[model samples]
Target: DQQVKQNSPSLSVQEGRISILNCDYTNSMFDYFLWYKKYPAEGPTFLISISSIKDKNEDGRFTVFLNKSAKHLSLHIVPSQPGDSAVYFCAASAFAGNTPLVFGKGTRLSVIA
Candidate 1:
């Protein structure tokens, strides 16, 4: 079974709108979570991240929120643009350093103009 789950396989939002992507994890050991955005035929790139200790982290138009009690997290993008369309993957790491990350099946996001 997957340790992490994106639940939604795809999402669509109009330009200048807000897009909310959700993720849930089954493993309690996970202490860190990161959101990765991938384009066609390209590798996933880090977008935003949050630690178990932090409930929310924001970077410009992107914000990541962690709900430890629910083992859930969400990525919010404000004013979603066409360029923001891509596959988003949620990843979790248990210990610090180079530990292997558990990844959820990515969710493809389409930002329509």
Candidate 2:
């Protein structure tokens, strides 16, 4: 089953604090992992990604860590801001190009003042 799971529906954090979101996958075939941040009625933009070949990937304020053995991954946002308040989606692709990407329901994050 091509299910990428984000069990938490929402998270609230104070400004300048770290925010962490968790995800899990049931499909062993998934080799690429991505985290997308979305606003209302907007499509998701690519945040950061980690390939199955690597255990960790980082970009600016965002970081993604993947554990293939546990089929689990997490996204960490440092110094979270009010602007970071939005929905975050966890996605997986077995292969690049043309293949459809599977996405989880999403996690709504709210950064407080």
Can you give the TM-score per candidate against the true fold? 0.97, 0.94
For model 1, what is the alpha-carbon lDDT of residue 87? 98
> How does residue 106 of candidate 1 score in lDDT?
88
Which lDDT tens digits does candidate 2 get at residues 24-66? 9998888988899999999898898889999989999899999
Model 2 stretches with alpha carbons more than 4 Å out: 96-98
Q: lDDT per model, in order?
A: 0.93, 0.92
Question: Which candidate number has the best lDDT?
Answer: 1
> Candidate 1 — which residues are off by over 4 angstroms?
none
TM-score of 1: 0.97
lDDT of 2: 0.92
For candidate 2, the per-residue lDDT at 20 reads 97
- Residue pairs that clash (backbone atoms under 3 angstroms), model 1: none
